[model samples]
Each structure stands twice: as C-alpha cells, then as structure tokens.
Target: MNHGPDDLSSTGEFDSDELALRRMLQQAVQEMEPRDGTLDHLRKAVPARRARKRQAVVGMAAAALFFGTAIPAVVHVSSTGTSANTSNAGHASQTQGGAGQGKEEEGGESTSGGSAGKPEDKGKGESKDADKGKSAGASTGASSGTDPSTSTAASAAVCTAVQLGTPTATTAVPDASGTVYGTFHITNGSTAACTVSGPGIVTPAAQGAADASKISALRHVSGDVASAGLPDPSQEVAQLLLQPGSSYDVKFAWVPTETCPTSEPSTDPSPDPTTSPDASSSEGSSTGGDTGTSTQLLTEDGTTDGSVLVTNTAEGGGPSVSTTVSNACAGVVYWTGLLTSS
Candidate 1:
C-alpha cells in the first residue's frame, strides 16, 4: 500500500513538494497590502459603472418602444389618406356619369357614341334645339295673351240709338253770372255692352224761347267758372264702355252774354169792358205791359224762357235729348266729355 511520489500523483494526492509550494503562496497572500485610496476608488467606480449600464438598458428599451408605435402610426395615416383619395375619385366619377346621363336623355344621344360630327347626330341636335325654342315661344305667348282681351273689352261696339235709353237732363240754380250748370244722363237700355265716345251734340229745344243762333254757339271746354261746385270734366274719360243698365254723365255749362233781347208787349186788342174785372186783369197779366223793355227771365222749369237739346251723334246719329238750360242773356254753351256716375 506504500507508494512512491509518482504513485501518489497518479492517485490524485499532494506530495511533500506540492504541500511546501502551497504553503509558500499562502504566506505571500497573507503579507500582501493594497495601494493608498484603492478601496475608495473601487467603491465609487462600481456604482457609477452600474448606473451607466442601467441607463444604456433604459435607452435601448425606449428607442424600441418609440419605433414600434411610430412605424404603425405612419402606416395607418398613409393608408387612411389613400382610402380618402380613392373615395373622392369614385364620387367624382359617379357625378360625371350622372351628368352624362342627363345630357344623353335631353339630347337623345348616348355618351358612348362619340361621333358628334355625323350628319344624323347634327340633325337630332338641331331638332332638339328647335323644340326647346318652340316651347319657350309658347310659354311667352301664353303669358302675353291677357293684353288683347283687355283691349277688346275697352273697344266694345259703339252704342246705337236703339240700344240707348231715353236720356234725361237736369239743371242747377244759375250763378250770379247767369251761368247755368247741368248734366245729361245717358243710359244703356239694351242687355248688351256698348261704348259711348266724345261729348255728343247739344242743341236747344224748339219749344222754349231759345234763339237758334245763340244755341248754335256751343263750345267744348275742360272747365269754366260756370262749372264750379261740380266734378271737373277735364279729368273724365273721353270714351266709356257701358254695361247693360249702366249710365254716364255729361256736364254742361250755359254761360250767358249781354246780347239777349228783352221781352216785348203783345199788340193784341184789350179784352171787352163787359168782360169780368178778374178776367180782364188775367188777360192783361198774361200779356206784358206796354212799357219799357224788361230783362229776359229764366225759370228753373225751363218753361219760362230758354232751353237746350243734346244729341249723341257719336255713332253718326242718335235721338236728340232736350234739357232746360234757360239763359236770360244770349250766351255760349259748354259741354264736357263722358264722366262715370258716382
């Protein structure tokens, strides 16, 4: 069992020489001393080194997280923009297509048939344009049709003598100037409508003491002092369409002059003395006194002295209507145009 040093080495046991060498290393380690300040330097260097390592790790993680979120966000934004552009393009195409369809319907042509230079297409286009023009013209004509109707109503046939009712006359109290103002009322007796134009012919009645020469001196005026307190005839219409049973007024002024003749006494023989006194007095009163000439008298009833006659001759001829416009002195007559009744 006792082996040599070579036998002990093969058996993994330390010999006397190895034991002595280990003892020498231990002795050297026990006697060794660090340089001054070496511990403090190591203490500070260790924590700083650890902090640098941690900062490097955190920086790497943050860079990774930022890149991860940023790349996807960029991709999403790019995709969204692309989608919006595509949608806008689609909508634009649809709008254009609809417009094309409308044009096709109106012009009776297809968008695919781009042969605009063909004779048949040109003819169709011209025909459509002509139809549009015709429609516009028809609309315009329909809108303008009201004026003719109004003009027709205004231009009714002239009233005839048979269609007119018997005209009546009225006279107002004479003014201080012996100017008599009155009105002539003309009516439409027939059922039909008719027109009366202009101030009709006016003449004095033959029954009164109206002088023919004086009556012939009638004048037409817009207005005069004799027409005061009455409606102004200047503003009245010259012509009027009268419906059945309707009436119109014509104002007249009888202005007297100083040339009228005075009354003259009758030359008849005096009544017999045997006649009763009352009868004689009546007869004498009936005849004017044989004395100086007296001024002509005009009464309200027109039987006293003078008279006037009015005839509507607008239709060539009509019945003569007479009104009492007795003027004491010889004067001119003024008549007015047609005036609507109040």
Candidate 2:
C-alpha cells in the first residue's frame, strides 16, 4: 500500500535498483583451494583389488597341495608317502653285513593278506608286533616288471607279496636321467646291521618332450605297512632293526603316460613306453600367480585285490586323464607310496 519506489515499478516486482545490484555481486566472490594431487591419484591406482586377494590365498595354497599332500604322495609309486625310515629315534643297525648281516631278530610284524586292492579285504589290524617276523622270496619269481604268471583281469592285483614289516634292501639307483643305472631298493629292515632306510628310488615325474617335470629315483615302496617282513639271502631285513618285528615290501615301479588315462582298465603294458620312462608325478598350483594343474596318483602294479588306481590316457591330442586319492595313512609307521598300472 505504500508503493513509492518508482510506483513500485508499475506493480511488476520489487527491485530497489535490482536489490542494490545483487548486494554488489555477493561481495565479489572468491574461495577455491582443493587440488594438491587429488589424493595422490587415488593412492597410485589401488593395485587392482589388492592383486586379486593375493592370488586367491595363493590359489588355495596350490589347491591344497595337489589336492592335498600330493595325493598322500601319489598314494604309492613308493610314490613318496611317508615311512622311509620314518625314524622313531631308535636308529641303530647297519653294522656292515651284506645278506641280512648279523642274521636278524628285532620285534614286530609278519602275517600278510590284506589290501590286495579290495576284495572287501579285512586283515589290517596287526603289524605292530605280529610274532617277531621273517620270510622272503616267498617265491613266484618274475616281478622285475611284474608277470607272476600273467593273468590279470582285475578284482585284485595292484601289488601283493605280503610278508609284513621287513623287506626293503638293495639300494642302487640311477635312471630318470641321473643315469646312475640299474638296481635300486632300500630300507631292508635290519636290527643290527644295515640300519633302516625303509624306502628308496624316486623317479616320480614323466611326460615330457616339452612339459618338463622329468624326475627320477625309482624304488619307493611303502604302503603304510601294517606289516613288512621277509628279505634274506642278502636282500636284507632279518630285523637288523625296525621294531614291531618286520613285514615290508615297499617295492617301486611305475610306467603309464603315453597319454596315460588308459580308459581305466589294464592287464599289462609292462614298462615299455619305448623303454619305461614311467613313475609320473606332475602336481602343480598357482591361482593368482596364474598357473594350475592337478593329478596325484598313477600306477602300473600292485598285483592283488584290485590293484590300486585312477586313470585315463591320451595326449598330443589331449582328453583323457585321472588321479585322485583323497587320503590314507591308517596310522603309525605304515607306508604305501605304492603303484601299479602299467
């Protein structure tokens, strides 16, 4: 009702000269400051999500170490499972007697028959002290590459020469390229001479021509022996020392990888892939490191029950494979780093 400022601009809107010229343009604005490096370029680009969670905890610790402890160390190519002179701290024998030395006598094992590969097999509760052990060359002779008589269709036979807790002497390896040449066996259970080596030979890697795992030692034998005796006439093990008596046959030999998946059923390929390069052991992992592979067991002989296995063969073309053993130790000083698949 007081309409004065130029008659209130003819009733349009108030503008006391444009409200004092917008308060002099908000007092001449000016206040910026915020550009040091923009937080150092996001802290140097953040290392791509902490490098993919440290490569997935190292690819699940290398996929549980080849599906867990190298399939119990390949289950048995004497495959490197455990008990090769596992060492109870007793350690005494090997005085220097060639054929079972002092003639033997210690404390446990003896009475085979069990785990021929599963005939619903029962027998494995005794081997700790089965009546003081002894026996060898139970005789059928042949087993250099295995052919007792040659009649394997399978229900048994991955390896069976059960005596239980002593056998394992012969030491003399050199192949897989180290080229030591001929004769390789160990652990010949002795209580007074030739102590306990229990296991020997290692050649557990093959399949080359550019893959490059290629290892060699052979003679691994150690099936968690609930028993392992027998080995005299110089082969050793008359209980030079390996308490609980003796029952051992932790033998060693393997050959399967000409692409070796073999459709999972074999009678005899018997070490001739061109000349037995056998004893395979490829086993790898590295997720964030970026490389991964899996396989743990491969055999060619066990000789009874069902003859231990898991296989598939095909390569160059590629598409047949197998190796899986989850876990099997049983308990105390037993070893079965065994193998048999030809």
Candidate 3:
C-alpha cells in the first residue's frame, strides 16, 4: 500500500523537469513588466487627442457662422435684383411691355419668379398715385376756400354818413384849468351801410344873439376849424364804414373861463387895429347902438358861452348831417385848430 501512494518510479527525472518549468515561468514574468517611457508616451498622446477635438469643434463653429452670414447676404442680393427687374418690367408694361424681350436678348430669363410679383407692385403704385392726386386736390380746395384779398374787401366795407345819427355832445367834469372836454358820438342808426370821412366843420353859435345874422357875423375867419390830431385826418385815411348799430366818436374841447392873451407890439412892423378904418367904424357902431349888449357871447353864469354847431360831410355826393352842440369852445389841437372828426 505504501508503494501505491508514493510510487515514483523515476523521481529524480521528474525533479529535473520541475526545475526547468520554474526557470521558464520566472523569465516570462520579467518579460511581461512595463517599459520606462510607456507612461510618458501615454500622457503626451492624451493632450494631442484633446487638441484635435478642440480644432474640430472650432472648425464646425466657423463653418456655421460663415453659412449663417452668407445665406442672408445671398438672399438680400437676389431680392434686390428681383425688385429692380420688377420695377423695370412694370414701367415697360405701362409703356409697351417690351422690356422682357430686351432682357431676354441680353441673356436674362423672361419667365423669372419675380415676373409674377410685378402685377401686385403695379397695383400698389397705382394706389399711391391716386392718393397723391387726392391729397393735391384737398390742398387746392383749402387754399381756394379762404382768399385773403376777398376776405379783406368784404370786412372793410363800412357804413356811410347817410346811415348815421346826429352827433350828440357829452361833457365831463372840468379840469384844473377850467378846461372841459366835449366828446361827440355819432351812431349808425339806419339799415343802409355808410362811410364817414373828412375833418368836419364846427361853428360856435353865439348865445343871446338878437338875430341869426348877428350870430353868423360873430364867427371869424380865425376861429374853430378842422385840424389834424392823433390819427391825422389830413392824411389819406381809409374810410371808416359803419354797419347798422355801429358808432364813431369825435372830440371837441373848450376852456369857458379862460381869457384871451393881451396882444403886445412886436419888433416886426404890424398894423394897429385903432388906426384901421374898418376897426374904427366897427368900434364907433358898437359904442352907439350896442352899448350894453356884449359882442362876445357870455353864458348866464358870466362865463363865455361855448356853444357850437357841427356838420359832418358825406363821401361820394351823399347827404350831410348837422348837429348843434351847446357849450363847446375853441381848443388847441396839435398846434392847430381842433374841429370834429374821428
């Protein structure tokens, strides 16, 4: 039984074969170890691979940007050319429709897609022209509606003297110098329009005169007359035409208590009233018949009577109107005599 369990008939021979197998395994393990530069080569290869991937990604982005820019540019250019051709075609169609044939002669396509859009463009153009014409007509109508000269003439027509009422005198409180201002207002009372012009006449009616002839004789050549004032009635002024119920105003002034200044002889040779024949005769007659009766009129309160008669002359051969104003004396207006006018 012991021979059966450890029965190595050639035990020394098997031992030599085991030593050879162990030597072969040791040599194979040493051959299988990594080389010195293997990890360094792997690190270098990883960076190279990452750099290539980045380059590929950058190239793809650049291509996308190029295509994005180029596509819209191409579309814009194509659309611009199409619009130009369409406009030309429209113009030609309106005239003779021969531009397409000419373009075809120049190596251009006659059946282009832009040809279909020409009808719509022409419709738009016609609508625009119609709108322009409408606008022009509206502007012309607006201008014609309000003509300046016609409006001015219509507004300037005024009432004449034939339509006016008699001038009425109004007296205000006297000033410090015993001077009173008399304002005469003339109103247009008739239905007819009229114009009043000129420096009207004012005659002071002598109060308590025995006869009208004596009152006329009291009026002297050097008395109240028409004179230019603020508006300078002497200048060519536009006629003030008044409508119905319109009115105009004129001013008359006086100083009832003021005395005439005493006359003094000057260095210049002047005629003496006492030596004159007419003055001597007038003084002798006044002393004989009219001794107590004063030549110059005086009011009841001993002040000089300042009564006046105003006459308004009409324009263009129209009838004149007269008014009698009581208590209006002569006044200085702009270094001349102040009469009646507006």
Candidate 4:
C-alpha cells in the first residue's frame, strides 16, 4: 500500500489487540476522574506549581497529536507525567494548608514543611524561611539566621576594643582656668609616683600672688618645691621638696595688685642741713622725727624703730628717699620711700 507520507505506517499500525487495550485505558481513565466534591477539593488544595506543570504537559501532548505526531510510547509517558504532577500538587497544597489554616478553604493553605522534620527544628526553619525567603530546609545550622552575622560583628567589636584600649580626652582652658586629666597603671613593684602639677614635674605656671592661701594653692599645683630648710608654710620660699613614694601637686594662679608709679627725680641732697642740733641729744630730751623729711618705717618686730629713720632730702623735695646713717652694711634689707601722692 503506497500511501501519502502523513498516512504511511510501517505495515504494523494499531492492530485489533492494541485498539482494544486503548479503549479499556480510556474507560478506566474516565471512571477514575474526580467526582462529587473531589474535583473541587483537589482544585482548592492543589498548588500552582505541579498543577501548572500538568497543564503544560497536556497542552504539548494535544498539539503533538493534532499534528499527527503521536507515538504510542510518547503519549503514554505524557499522560502519566500529567497525572503524577497533578497528584503531587494536591499533596503539596494539603501539607501547606494543614500547617496554617488547619483547613483548606476557598484557597489551598501554605506550608513550611510540617511532617518533613522534628517539630522544634521545623519551627526554627519556618522562622528562618520567613525572614530570609530561603528554603526552610536551608535552615539547619546556626548560620541559618541573621543572628550569626550580628554575632560576628559583635566579636569583631570586642576584639577591636581589647586591642585599641580607651579613647583620649582633650580640652582647652584659659590662663586662669585649666583642665586636669591623667592616667597611670599600677603594678606590684611600681609603688612610687612621678609627681607633677600645673603641667611641670615640680614647677607651676607663674601668676600674681597675694597672701598665704594663694601661695598654698600654687604649692599644691607645683608639686612641692625642693628645699633643705624647715618645712614651714609660714616662711616665704622659691621652691620645696617632696617626700618619696607620695605625690604632691599645686598651682600658682592669681592676679596681683598694681603699685603707684615713681615721679621725676629731685635735685636736692640727701641728709640735708637738718636741725643744727645734730650734735647730740640729751638722753630722752624731747626728740621726734622731723616730719618734713624723715618717713615712718615699720620694723620686722612689727614695732616702729624711730632710731632708723629715713628722709626724702632730694634737691627739689621730689621723688626720692634715703635711710639714716646707721647699720649701713650688715645683709639687712632696708626700705626707702619714694614720694607718692596721698
């Protein structure tokens, strides 16, 4: 039989036996189809994944058959694949629904794999899946959650802190105001302290000084001056020493009072021709300082010694003063007056 290409068979087309088998298969398929509420339940429970795949396979099979490209073996496989895909989709949907709604309503329920693992492990997996959008099965180890990343960051921070130590403090201060800050580590053998004050080890910044209080403050900041004399705060000194092992600190900050300025010098001679009674005084002979020339002086003993008088006997009775002719030499500091307006 020499037929057209589309109609030609290998002289062994569908025999009676083959045709009967096909008819039986078609009847069985029709009988096995979902009935009553079964089709509705399956549609509600089936997921889009396998259902969509089933539809694709069936469409491909229909197109191939219409074009007369049917191969019996290929058709059998295609139909089987569609049925398996639809069944798997229904099962997947049911699992998803049970995990959530406990019941499949109009739409199928979703699942994060309930029966797939232990309840505890499944819960953790679901949580990770929700956060990362990854497969629940991927959440098996500690690295599954974002917490691992945070933990790594925290560890890095702690290591950095341990290596870098503490931050330094800085501040600016004026002449009268100053910032105080320092740090030192203590060890068993290191008991002595290197004392300092006002920025130097033993010296302090210079400022105006008044009474003992200000001086004491300076000493406190200056870390005690070095000296060999008595350690009396009452005495005046430039520097002092400190005891070992113990630290001392101090500061010298104060403003001084202003003194009057000296005027022009006079042309008058000192020790001028005063009382011609310069010969000698009768013991207790009504004697007193010539108020016109001599000036008053307070002594160390806090008493006024009229014997050691001074006079401003300048040429024009202007700015200068001089002491009397007694105790001229001996290492004593005598005070001379300079003329000042009252």
Candidate 5:
C-alpha cells in the first residue's frame, strides 16, 4: 500500500496479467472459423450488392434523362396541336361565313326578282347585267394597262423599202486574211415604227462593166474572219423593231482570192521603129519582139483587177440597196443577219 506508481508498473504480477490477456485474444482469433464457403459467398455477395447499387444509380439517371427530354417534347406537341386546331377552326369559320354571305346574296336576288315580276323588267335587268359585264371587262383591261393583241399587231408591222432611208456603208482596211470588215447601215426614216423580219436577201450585183469572172461569190454567213468586234448574228431578234431615226446594221466581210489572175498583154504593135530611135529600140527590145505575147499581173488595188458589187434586197419585195466592195481578187463574201446598231 505504501509502494510508488513506478514501482508498481515494474511488478511481475501486472506484467503476467497483460501477457495472459494478449494470449487469450490470440487464441480466440486462432480458434474462430466461418462456415463452408463463407469467404467465397461474402466475396460474391459483396460484388453483387455493389453491382445492384450501380445499376440502380444508372437506371435513376436514365429515367431522369428520359423524363427531361420527354416532358419538353410533349409540351411542344401539345402546343402545335393546339395551334393547328385553332387554324383549322379559323379556316372553317371563314368558309362558313363565305357560304352564308353567298346564301344571303342569293336570297336577296330571289326576293328582288319576285318583286319585279314583269318579263320586260327581267329582260331590262339582263341587259343592265350585260352592260355591267362589258364595263367590268373594260375596267379589267384598263387595270392591266396593256392589250396583248394590240401590242402584237403593232410590233408585227414590217418595214417597207419606202420607210427605209438611203443605206450607207463603211469599210475597214483589209486584214491579214484579206478579209475586209464593213457595215451597211439601214435607217428607219419613216415616222412610224416598223420591224425588220429577218436578214434580207443578199446577192452580188450582175457583173456590170467589171469582169464577170472576177466577181466575188456572195454567201450568207453568221460570222467570219475579222467579225469579232461585230454583234453576234445568232443573238439578233427574229423581228427587229426600229423606231424612227433609229438605224440597224448588216455586217459583212469580204475574203479575197488567194491568187489573182494575170491580164493579157496589150495588142498594140511594138513602137514603130521609125519613131524616135531611142524609144523604138527600148520598147522593141523590152517586148522581146513579140506582140501581145507578154502577160501582166493584176494589181491588188481592185482598180485594175475587179470590184465586187453587193446588193441587199429586203424580204417580201423592197427596194434594194447596193454597195461597191472593192476586192483585189475573186473570193467569198460573208454577210450576217440584221443587227441593232450601237
């Protein structure tokens, strides 16, 4: 009873008691044993329980997502259905009102007819209705602002030679291809507007005064060499309308022959030997003492060669317009359809 606390902690009795408690706890733990397959069952059951909990969580989340989307879709469908029903109701009401108004009009017309029993009165009413119909038709036409038939007839009036002014032409210098570009301007000098239906007949004038063999062959073509700057013939209107003072153009190109024909030498006898001795001797020696045997090449100026005369006659018989297209040699002449001038 008088011993101190440190001296008690070193006593053999307290140490032996602690050792006994430890031994008993060890023995209890060693002696304990579960039933057969308890560990395996615990292992399987624990995982199965955790899996169930996970499945429950996933199911709850999926249900929440489904409801979240489904509620808005349901609401939208309901609103659309309501709007459609309202529109249908409104259209139905309008249709019913129109039908009722028609019925009322028919009733009023019947009542008025009953009041006016005379056959003459009925005929007068019909006449008035006819006049009203005519007036209505006229008002409709005025409202539309144009008559197709009248416009068509006005535009269809073809131009005659008397209505056309004197045609003028301008020719450009020949290109490397020997193609000369020119435009024949035809003016509508008449006061009234007229249409040119198509490209009129183009023909080479009868070889008058010029060599017949050297006349350029006239050919109607859409386009040809050096025609790039000219208007496209294919795009021309079928009926070209020309107002007063307005002019149209007919583009043409002249292609000269590749080679020119040589002219026969003059038939005049060699210079008289009795004339001046210097001139007679020079001319006689130059002529090789032959008369009319020398050949001379034709010049490309068309003055000595030959000129092409192009004549354009409007379709349906109109006074023809002619132009002298100078060509160095014989070749084809290309002409295009009527084109609106700039």
Candidate 6:
C-alpha cells in the first residue's frame, strides 16, 4: 500500500513533512531535564502557609478574649472566694477552707482573713523573725555602729572606786621660801586594777562640830579633783593606774603668803528685793551688784571641827572613805596641779 507523498497529501492524509516534524519534536523533549516533585512540593507548601496564618489569627483572638473576659472572671473568683462577705457566711467559710488548704500545698502560707489563719500567720511571723535574728547575729561582726556586747566589755574594763584603798599623807621640811611640800600615797587593795584622780582637797582635820586648834597652819582646801578625761584647753590630766598592791603619790604645795587676789567691785546699781516674792528665796540671789564674798585661807571661826569626805567617781557607788589632815598656817595661798606618780 505504498503510495506517493503528493497523492497522500491530496487525499487529505498525514503528509511526510508533518510526520518528520512531529518526530523531531518528540526527540527534543526527551533530551531536556525533568523536574521531579517540584510541583508537588509547591502544592503542599501553599496550603500549609495559609493554615499557619489562619491558626495565628485564631490564637490572637483567643488571647484577646481570655484577657478581656476570663481574666476578670478569675480575679473575681480569687477575691470573692478568699475575702470576707457578710451576706454569704457559709460560702466564705468554704472558700476560706479551700484557700487555706491550697496555700498550704503551695507554700504553707495561710491567707490572713479569718480567725483560723491567725495562728498560722503568727507562727510563721515568729519563724521568720527567728531566721532574721540568726542571720543578723551571724553578720554582727561586719555590721557598723554601736554593739551592746562590745560596750559592756568596755565598761567592765574601766577602773572605779571599788578597787581603791585608803590614802596616807607624810610631810617634808619647809623650803627656803617657807613653802610646805607634802606627799600623799594611795594604795590599791582590791583584787583588780583601778584608776585614781587628784587635785583633791587638803584642810584642817575635824571630827564633829568645829573647834579651835593649836596648829600653826591655815584652814585651806585645795582645788577640784583632777579629771581623768580631757577637760580644758590649757591643762591635761592623766589618771593614776594602781594595780593590785601598788600605790601612787599626789604632791601638795602650800605657800604661806599674806596677800590675796580680789575681783574688782562692779559699779552697777543693786537690784531691789522688795519687788520679789519672799525673803527666803532671796537668800543666795545676787542683786546685780558686788555681792561675791571674799575667799580666805583661814576659817571665820578659826576652828577645825568638820569631818573629811572623800568622794570617788565610780559606777554603782563604791565604798565610803575619808582622809583627815590639819593646816593651821594663816593667810596661806594654796594651788594644786594634775596627779602624777614618781
């Protein structure tokens, strides 16, 4: 049935030229690269991306709804359930019981609302304070400021009159200027050490009432006791440290002179006592005039009838003590200095 190419074309059948072109096209398509699974991957990825976006939108809406509605509901439940309400006593009790048990399971802390929780709250507060105390005690050494234990130890180490003993006096010969010098010795009789201060008084010895004496010295008292602390700008006082069975001396100097220094009289007018209340109140009051009395070495009555009183500076008030000495010289000027040990 082999027919010519022109006759097949005229009979409206497949031409030779069209057949060759189809064969060439098929061969070219087969030689090209094939894409495996690319379309399938794209088809899978588009729907997955759309699903994730939709899920995100749904999650945002759910979160907004929970915050706007469910959160307030939970808050109302927590507040109404845990707190007191006079209208609903039974409900409050039940809620309180549940809250207490729940709190115990959480951290052993009962809400401070009803009487049932008060005891637990008190015990927990006490436990917390005890823990704080232990931590504070552990860090005490590193803390700044005053500590009670340190202050107590320091006070215990300070010396006082409880350890001081009786003082004895001895006289020496008069110098070329007729000034009398003497030494008084104080011994520590206690089992511990002590501190003693001086510039103490020295006057004529006495017993009960003052009476005339035959001694040829003036009745004069020395200045105040030399302080064991910093007192003034011009003078420095050092206290005597007396150990057990130890002693220290205080030197005394007396000048038998006649002249005495006096304060000049003030020219201001005196105040009137008639305008005041009573006479007894005006006894020691100065009237803005020259009312200061003169100080003399000799007593007015010329008697040595007073008792000696020795006052010691100490806490808790120690033992009672006295020193007796007589000075009968007339018109004598006396001066005392800081205490010293030689």
Task: Candidate 3: list runs displaced more than 4 Å.
Answer: 1-156, 165-167, 172-176, 192-242, 255-257, 260-294, 297-330, 333-342
Tens digits of lDDT, candidate 6, 278-321: 66455535444484532232344444223222222222243333
Q: Which ten residues in a row have the lowest lDDT in candidate 1?
A: 143-152
lDDT of 2 by residue, 37-107 (tens): 97777777677668888999999999987687766657763634345544322122222211223232232
Ordered list by TM-score, greatest first: 5, 1, 3, 6, 2, 4
Error of 5 at 125 (Å): 19
For lDDT, candidate 4 versus 5, the one ahead is 5
Worst 10 residues of 6 by lDDT: 147-156
Q: What's the CA error at residue 160 for candidate 4, in Å? A: 8.3
Per-candidate TM equals: 0.44, 0.15, 0.33, 0.15, 0.44, 0.27
Who is ahead in lDDT, 4 or 6?
A: 6
Q: Each prediction's Cα lDDT score?
A: 0.64, 0.30, 0.49, 0.32, 0.64, 0.48
Best by TM-score: 5
lDDT of 4: 0.32
**Per-residue C-alpha lDDT of model 3 across residues 159-242, encoded as one tens digit per residue:** 444566554656556566545455556666786544445324444443333223323211112333322112233322334444
Tens-digit per-residue lDDT, 1-342, candidate 1: 777556767877897789668668878897789999999999999999999999999999999999999999999999999999988875565454454344453556543334323434577788999999999987555433322222223446888888876887787887776777777787778877777775577654432455666554445544555456456655677576677777777777777664344445547887688989997655535435675334345444433464555443433377456666544435666766667765
lDDT per residue (tens digit) for residues 242-298 in model 5: 666777777777676654545555688776667899876565444445554332334
TM-score attained by model 5: 0.44
Kindly report which residue stretches of model 5 are placed more than 4 angstroms away from their true locations once superposed. 1-156, 206-230, 264-267, 270-304
Candidate 3's error at 334, in angstroms? Answer: 7.7
Off by over 4 Å in 2: 1-183, 186-192, 205-210, 213-250, 260-342
